[model samples]
Target chain A: MNEKKLKSILEKIHDKNYDCMILTQFNNIRYISNYAPTSFAICLLKDDPIILTSSMDKELAEKTSEIPVEEFKSFNELKKLFEKDNFKKIAIESSISISLFRKIEGNWDLNIEDFLEKERMIKSKDEITKLEKAAGISHKSFKELNPMKKREDGFTEWELAYELGYLLRKNGAEKESFETIIATGTNSSLPHARTQNKKLQTPILMDWGCKAEGYCSDTTRTFVYSEKQEEIFDIVFEAHNKAIKSVKAGIKSCEIDKIARSIISEYGYEKNFIHSTGHSLGLDIHEIPSISKKDETILEKNMVITIEPGIYLEGNFGVRIEDTIIVGKNKAEIIGNLPYSI
Target chain B: MNEKKLKSILEKIHDKNYDCMILTQFNNIRYISNYAPTSFAICLLKDDPIILTSSMDKELAEKTSEIPVEEFKSFNELKKLFEKDNFKKIAIESSISISLFRKIEGNWDLNIEDFLEKERMIKSKDEITKLEKAAGISHKSFKELNPMKKREDGFTEWELAYELGYLLRKNGAEKESFETIIATGTNSSLPHARTQNKKLQTPILMDWGCKAEGYCSDTTRTFVYSEKQEEIFDIVFEAHNKAIKSVKAGIKSCEIDKIARSIISEYGYEKNFIHSTGHSLGLDIHEIPSISKKDETILEKNMVITIEPGIYLEGNFGVRIEDTIIVGKNKAEIIGNLPYSI
Candidate 1:
């Protein structure tokens, strides 16, 4: 972020009478310092921004951080720093734990603040580039997953998940955004089934992602075999398609969800559509302004989110199709080039 | 995980005047109910315990949870249920976000409580068995790695990590507890260095672990090929050994940290010993009563922790030795049988 943007954030924080802010969330820290912490790190944003990082992270922080970095010594020493500063009103991120919050709250007038989250909602050009790269890597890796080879040779669910992870990393991703889901056979009936040590079964559903330069990519594809599977697949696909088509700058996030749900409801499978239409993705796999019925946040330009719609049949199978789209002025631009149908 | 034990926990919460407790943080939920949520789940502990789980997690929750499970419709719906029950004082786990706290705080009187954490601190026989199994799988996987194999045909940091993870899963591990850290060459100097796509170098420092039955196991091995590496390794090994030896019921956790620090200080590398001596581990990779300089919590029987000590030479290399141990009545019982020296 530019100095002006950072200063603007500080000004907004000041309007809330926050003399100091504690940022522990890695992504929030990265937004200000340009250094994503590998281990534990804390940033105290006051008159002059500073980062206290673990000794192991010092080298990396020094190399990447725009702000001055210090080796974190002890919590006692950290507590003393706050005392010395005499910070009366301290602002903390919502993600800060109650345990850690109580430890620090005893000494200061700490208030929960969304100052960082508000700033992070609007993606920078560099952040967009990283997200694009992550999406590209995920898409490329998906194509490389020759499931036919595994199907013939009899590969286990976890083995396929592991192979996809390896491919994602090999394709320039730093790591997977989350655990790769490879639910197959009857296990595919569970929307979030654990991978078992068994051979891949019919109508496989794989939900996976990759991370590049700290940005995350999320996508899911379900391969159907039986006619019943195909029938459910078409409804999910239509929900996915209509949801993606409904994306625009002025539209509320929930409207996108309605577009998906309306299609599934028309098929008399509204109850079968288990999860939300989608969720915003960036440094974190799940972010705010989710495409759920209750969320009324307006979709804005540069807001990247997943458009996933699924229908699950109890004890039978499930079908889900997902894609990430970056919101543009008039419409949303899909990030990956992979086809919805395989 | 017995009904009586669960009842006691509920009584403790009631004693603290908590009408209902919202449990997130997967491990905490698993500790209360056998079910570990894959997606999202919330256990509201009151007169009648009920788990509100996402549609994706319903099947798994139903299969594993001892408590009654219901589909999570929306936050508003959950709030309505709380209102219907006339719950006035709601307790929340410390792991909950400040945003979530604020969102729910408006509905009832909120207080951060460790009612569940206190219950989890003392493990039952079944929990210990699972932990031991996790440790066994991790040890067997490490033996299979045999850093000597990498010496025969050099491997990239990530490739070695991938192999270790694969081996762990092959040996019946549920999954890796966390990302396998295989820092070698100059990268070893930084404690939490990201693995690079390059051939392995001398003085390889590998920290790896795996999960079994929801319990975690952690271990680290450093390969020394030169005199300098051996010298640093010896100091770290002494610290590691002394720390483990110091672990016993009724002893202050920080005392064990002092033992390790004293060893490194005696070797004139006090400043090089960067992080804490050890940390408690179970379902979570890092847990409470950290064996740090300031922690005054007493060690208890059946508590599992890792004793890791390291010495670093910036831009040169680093050596670290780590092992998981179970705190017994008299001494620490090493969880894994992996040799310190390689």
Candidate 2:
């Protein structure tokens, strides 16, 4: 599987006339070499890619990396090797820090590209299986938590969030993909409110995910009680449903965002609908081809994305609904069978 | 406290003759504004520092930020604001991505500095209070876990790590400072080994920390059984003790590292000790002035650091002992009352 992935990346490097691609992002390195670095490490991708890791990571790298591993000494040593190999142009990840970029920009043309992200946008059958498993575990854990009961029992926002995390881990998730957001009542008006110690309130918005085999699953559900809250929830549910339904191979991602935005706009809550419709996910919780107004990346089969639409009424309350979906030839397949409503 | 922090940053900006210092790092923003952004945000440090946060973060930012908050529209809008303000020179954090640097690089002087890190190295009284509380909770929870009994019960490495995480949160930690490292038997030889599903084995090495009030506390302990393992553990403990004892205000951090390295080297395991002696800690787990051979940063009063030394024998096992300490005029004060020997 990695060989095919490497082949595509190599073809891109060759097309760009670059000698090699330097990947410092942990996920990118893991995608290419299967060695997820715990500390600083670099993956130099070429015909025969090699991972240069710290001395402390040499043992783990040797054990896990499919590609060859070597101990990284210093940039000076790496520069000497590049000079010896007569390398000139090299592709680099855009996430590289400017300080590190300056250290290696001496005698080479450093062309920044999102080659790994572009490659990762299209998941393989194995990748989709991992995502499905992650989604399954997350949904199963959420069901086990029974948020409805917890809310009735007067659980604090943090307690509910912590319980969900415990359930996720117990059900085989390595950990949460990101910090779980559990906003309640007026706090829900803030899209990314920190889980507070206050008791559960009328409306509860939870956006959470967990990782299974390095793949991430993200989903959000808002439980509402008041009539007004339910009204907003229904609008967000409509946007979420339409957005996911619009996903298909060969369509622009922005179009899906437009579909969701238009529905909320028609309800006169366009300004209240903050944030992107959704984002792609894999090893990392957030990836390229974000479902927003600006991204124009064409959707492709095997791509996994989320369709999350939210309506936040500042100082009052908010509602959001989300699900992970796999792009299909003519439609979209939701990853898990979790119910959209409470 | 935030006002004081902002004042210091603005003074530095004025001294450099820069119009503003753009901070993208979450910790820097939190340090200067008391608002930790959940999404993308920027802190523009000037006479009247302001934070530009995403629409999703505007509510939370408004509620938490000590400085004024504004909704960020786009990078082009920001460029126009800078042009309108006649800003010519700007300072940026070293961690800013090269791509972001490029976006705002045109017709302006961008100077990279570690101003925030330097300021953060010296902890305030309130910061120390938070760190001490974090350490107290971490040590108490470690005691509660009773790893000695967990080993007898034959728990898996990951299970033990998970249990510790549960204890930390239950004891009032926001979360783990980093992923808990619970490497048993030969796996412990890897300094940053991921917790595995394998049953417990001899020489269990556990490195863990927790966050309290946004501050972090880090500590490591190894449980050894065999005589050979005890010998290695003793050497590591000696190095750890001497390193902590040598810390004081006005000494270079490298001197403390040398004290620890020389002790380990005398045991003829210099090569076995692969990583630095220690590192500073605060809101972020790893801070500045790493206690390594090359770092000549002068230690100052109120600076909190860790003194951790380890010996890793490939294909065998590893032993590490760590403790967080506060630099004093004459000596270092270890934070928690946890015993060195378990």
Candidate 3:
């Protein structure tokens, strides 16, 4: 399984004329090696890749890493290990810190290239299975928590978020993909508002997710009680439904954004749609090929992404609907069976 | 207050002949502009500074920022704005991604510098107050949770972490400084162990903290059961105590590390003491001038840091003690009143 993930990256590195690729992003390293480093560990993707970790991480690394693990001593020693092999010109992740890049630079020519993100853009059957399973757990937990039914329970936003979190774990999620967002009332206008201690209000915007086997699931739903809130919610729901229907292999990511944006625009609320249509999610929540007006990557089969459309009316209220989907041979397969409206 | 924070960085930028400094790290930006970006945003520090944020964030930015806020467009447009000002060079954080650096490179000489970090190393009276408050709340919450007494209860590690999190929020914390680590028995051997769902064991290790107005406080306590665990705990406690007593404004960071490390070495378990002595913390959990053997930074007044010393017996169990402190004129001032031997 690890060999299959590494094959394409090796070919890419060879084409780019680099001897090896260095990966430091935790999720990227986890993609290549089963080990998700709890601390600093360097994954050098060579013909025979190795993970160099600190003494503190050695035991965990040796236990979990699919490849050979070595205890790191110093940069000088690390440089010597590579020099003995007469290596030159390395590809590094775009996320490498300048300090790390500098320490590893003097011995060889180093350039930042994201071979892993590109390779990860196309998901395998195993990866898709994890995403689907994560989505199922998240959806089931949402149903169990039933935010709409508990709307008037006098719970603070944080309390509701805690309840949902407990549900996610009890239903078999490893952890939440991100901190749960339980923005209510006027606070929902902020696209990425932090969960507050304020009481539940007329309109509540919940954006939450859970993880399964390192894969992530993201979802959002707004419970509306007033006529004005419902009117805005319907517009977002239409944009979301139409955008998912338009998704297919060969269509550019921006096309999906355009379809979603156009629906909101037709409703004369384009300016109120604060963020991108959505983004890709797998090991990490925000991955390559964001579904935004500026992103142009073509959709491909088995690439899982989300379609979240929101309309925020600043101090009044906001409404958003989100769902994860799998890019299919011809159409998008929405991941869960949650009701659109309550 | 923000002006006081920006003065040093502006001088450093001018000394290096750079037109301005570009900051993207959320805390660094917040340190200067008082607006922490939820999504992507750029802060330009100059004679007259401004924060360039997404339209989605413009509302919040305008509300919170001490400096002027503007809508960010493409990098191409940003280049034109700087070109109009006759800017020739700029300083950036080491954290700037290779992709972002390349996008902003065509017109200006971009270099990674740590002026903000060097400046943030010393906390202000206001920052110290927040840190102290954060530590107070965290300590009070731990007392309320009382892991020692809860050891016999049928609670999972995750459950303890959740209960502690609830207590932190209820006791006036904005949120946890980081995810609470609740490692029980053998799991505690991993320095950075994740909280598990397994039932609580005899010896419980919890490293936790909470945020007070964006400043962070970190503390760790290991609840030991058997005499073997208690014996290891005393060694760690002695190391933690002596290393902290050695903290003064004039000494080097490495000296403090050496003091703790030497005591652990004397106990014939130097190899068991796995990570660093400690690290500085403020807006971010880990900051500049780490209390490690390699760090030669001279301790300075008002520098807030942690002194956490531990000994792990690989597959058996682990014992650790940590405390946040303020480097004083001639001694160290531990932030919280939490009992050491509890």
Instruction: Give the winner by lDDT.
Output: 2
DockQ comparisons of all candidates to the true complex: 0.71, 0.83, 0.66
What is candidate 3's lDDT per residue for B1-342, written digit by digit as tens?
456767877899999999988998999889998888998999988999989999889888998999999999989888998899989998989888777777888667888888999999999999999999999999999999978666667888888888898899899898889889999979999888888889998588899999988999999988888999989998999999999999999999999999999999999989999999999999999998999999999999999999999999998999989999999999999997898657
lDDT (tens digit, per residue) of candidate 1 on A1-342: 467668978998789888789999998898888898988899998769899998878888998999999988767788889889777889898888777776776457888887877777767788899999998998898889887688788899989988988898889999999888898888887877878999999899989998998899998899999999999999998888888888989899889999999999999999888888999888889888789998999989988999999988888888988899999888888886787666
Candidate 3 residue pairs in clash (backbone atoms < 3 Å):
none
For residue A62, model 3's alpha carbon misses the true position, in angstroms, by 1.1
lDDT of 1 at B103: 62
- Interface RMSD (Å), each candidate? 1.7, 1.0, 1.5
Residue pairs in collision within model 2: none
C-alpha RMSD by candidate, in order: 2.3, 1.4, 1.4
Q: What is the lDDT of residue A307 in candidate 2?
A: 93
- Tell me the deviation in Å of residue A35 in model 2: 0.7
> lDDT for every model?
0.86, 0.91, 0.90
TM-score between candidate 1 and the true structure: 0.94
**DockQ, Cα level, model 2:** 0.83
What is the CA-based DockQ of model 1? 0.71
Candidate 1 lDDT score at position A76: 76
User: Distance from true position, residue A41, model 1, in Å?
Assistant: 2.3
